[model samples]
Target: MSVEAELIAPAELGTSVVSDKGESIAPQAKEAASGLLDQGDAMTSLAQQAPSVVERMQDFLLVGGPVVWILLGFSIIALSIVLVKLWQFALLRPESNRDVTQALALWRAGEHGQATVVLKRNRPVSELVYIAMRGVLNVRQDMDLLKDELERVAALRLNQLRALLRPLEVIATLSPLLGLLGTVLGMITAFQRMEAAGNQVDPSVLSGGIWQALLTTAVGLAVAIPVVVIHSWLERKVERVAAVMSDSVTQVFTGQQISVVAEPELEELKRAA
Candidate 1:
């Protein structure tokens, strides 16, 4: 009976240990399953909401009527112009100045050939500097004629940079007015509806109409603000480029004048020696 009791005690102890481990693992398993279920439910909810969000946007646009559509078109056109101007700036690098500085230094030091080579870069300022240096060294044209020619070239370059900027300005200027027009029209429509409804007019209807009328103004401002900022920034960039070109060309001519004045003095000193 004692041997049977000892054997039974060990078997019971082992069964209790297994039960304890199972109890601990069961809650952990349930927690992991609940976490996965929660994540799946969130993902499913987002998927269901996506189409509804799109529908709401479409309805909002439709409610704003033709003025909103016109603003939409303007926004697209503005975006396209901005992209084109950015690409043009990137390709031309109108802001590049280091090469122009180096070329001017070489020209001042009497290294005309090297200076011309230095100005060979694909930059607007470089092109202007190259033309000025070439005119002085090779053409030996009158300073007034050269200045006139440079002015023409500068005008052309500036015009290129200024391209499409007018359209952007127009868009920025017109957007708010168009939005105001839309709001006014919407307000007129809303009030007319209220007038038609007469004694049956509900406050909700008026409130809805007011908000919907205001929506055009909100969208117009949204479209105009960025466009105004972009236009100013782009205009400033062109101005900087123009300044650099003027400064560089002026330096080249100034250096040429100094050289011209010094050459006669050197010749006289040589004769005296």
Candidate 2:
């Protein structure tokens, strides 16, 4: 009778089984199903949160987008200037200092033709040497006149060098001022909102306004700092160019053994004649 009772209980359990395999569902399978349901709920919650994330991003852009654009414009201009200046300086570096020295020596030895040939043969440095040679040709024996002419040429070159750089300086000076303007505008907006909100001003609204105002200042500095650094570096380059000009002119003048001659004696001699 006990064996018969056990067999009946087994038959009842089999009848209760609803699994595809015709067996009771396993404990691990039940736990896995619960885990899947929890995962789905988490995904749904995350999906609900996505719109808030998008709103925050939109708000950030609405507040800071213009400042970012302005910074981008300035950066483009600055980078362009930097690249151009780098190219110009690289091209203008003295290619053959030794050739220039040899040319000076030849000119000092009274071999003016050979010196000119030396100047013509070399590249780039030749341009500088040629300028000095022209002054030598024009102000032949008058060192002061030659020096003055060489200085004039250098001044012209300097002007050319600084032509494009002026815009950079102007932009650098104006960027901060523009930032300040943006700050002021942002403040006005914030105050207007405060007035509109009246007694119900939210902290979030005020914080947003303040952040927007600060963006302009940050943008200004971002534009200004690099511009100043680039300007300073360019100014040094100009100074070095000036020094090179001076050195070249000096070499030519000294090589010719030329001195400024007083014209008073020549004028007296002409009068006597």
Candidate 3:
């Protein structure tokens, strides 16, 4: 009867074979329509269930206790930071060592401008290398000053790379201690309850508090271990970038120093000619 059903009915009935005994095609058409209706209902039901599932998760977090909830928050933050670092390295870190080597060769061959142009076009160059290449081209006599500037830039960018890592370090160190504190407090509460119910000492009271203590401790360890590993991995990556920056920039400026020293000698020989 509906517009959708009318349209679908013709397409479905064309595929279906009617009995030679003159069976009605109406039931088969209705069956096809019912299948479409069932699909729509299934989608509707899934949409309705989504919010209920979110509600259940919220309820679970609420019951996870403060220490557990704080650890949960740390876990999410750590995961996000790790993903960002991984993405950063994948984009910035080069797969081949030839980028720096080729650029160095260009600069040493009296093509200083061309070397910079090459570096600019290279997609996987480090930020440190890029900054150094831009600043060091005009540098001739002040190799010491250039070194100072490069060191300063390297330090600043290295710190930026290490930015979110400190929080992960803090989380790693604090989680286990928080778990222990929760366990101690839980034990204290359990004993107090036991003392108050001295004559009627229920086994449930003792066992229940102990389990809560264990749960908090377990959550803390779970949070701390992964946080520590992720922090270490990120720190290693930052260090590697720092080394590449330092080595590449040093190679470029070392050649520049040679050029500066030879410029005066070349000019003196020209006067003698």
Please report the candidate that would top lDDT against the real structure.
1
Top candidate by TM-score: 1
Give the TM-scores of the predictions, in the order they appear: 0.87, 0.62, 0.65
Error of 3 at 179 (Å): 0.9
Least lDDT summed over 10 consecutive residues: which range in candidate 2? 254-263
Distance from true location, Cα of 191 in model 3, Å: 1.8
RMSD of each: 3.3, 12.7, 10.0
**Which TM-score value belongs to model 2?**
0.62
Rank ordering of all candidates by lDDT, starting from the highest: 1, 3, 2
Q: What is the lDDT of residue 42 in candidate 3?
A: 100
All models: lDDT? Answer: 0.92, 0.75, 0.76
What lDDT tens digits, residue by residue, belong to model 1 across residues 1-273? 699999999999999999999999999999999999999999999999999999988998899999899999999999999999999999898997888888888888888899899775567788889888888886658878888999998999999999999999999999999999989998998899999999999998888889889989998998999999999999999999999989999999899888788999999999999
**Model 3, stretches more than 4 Å misplaced?**
1-64, 94-97, 108-111, 121-141, 256-273
Tens-digit per-residue lDDT, 1-273, candidate 3: 999999999877865654422467668888999999999999999999999999976764554468778888888888888888778667655434566677788877778777776664433334445566666765463757766876887777677678788988999999999989878877888899999998999999999878777777888899999889888878887777677776787777677678778989999999999
lDDT string, candidate 2, 6-76, tens digits: 99998887766655344445776788999999999999999989998999756755776586567668878
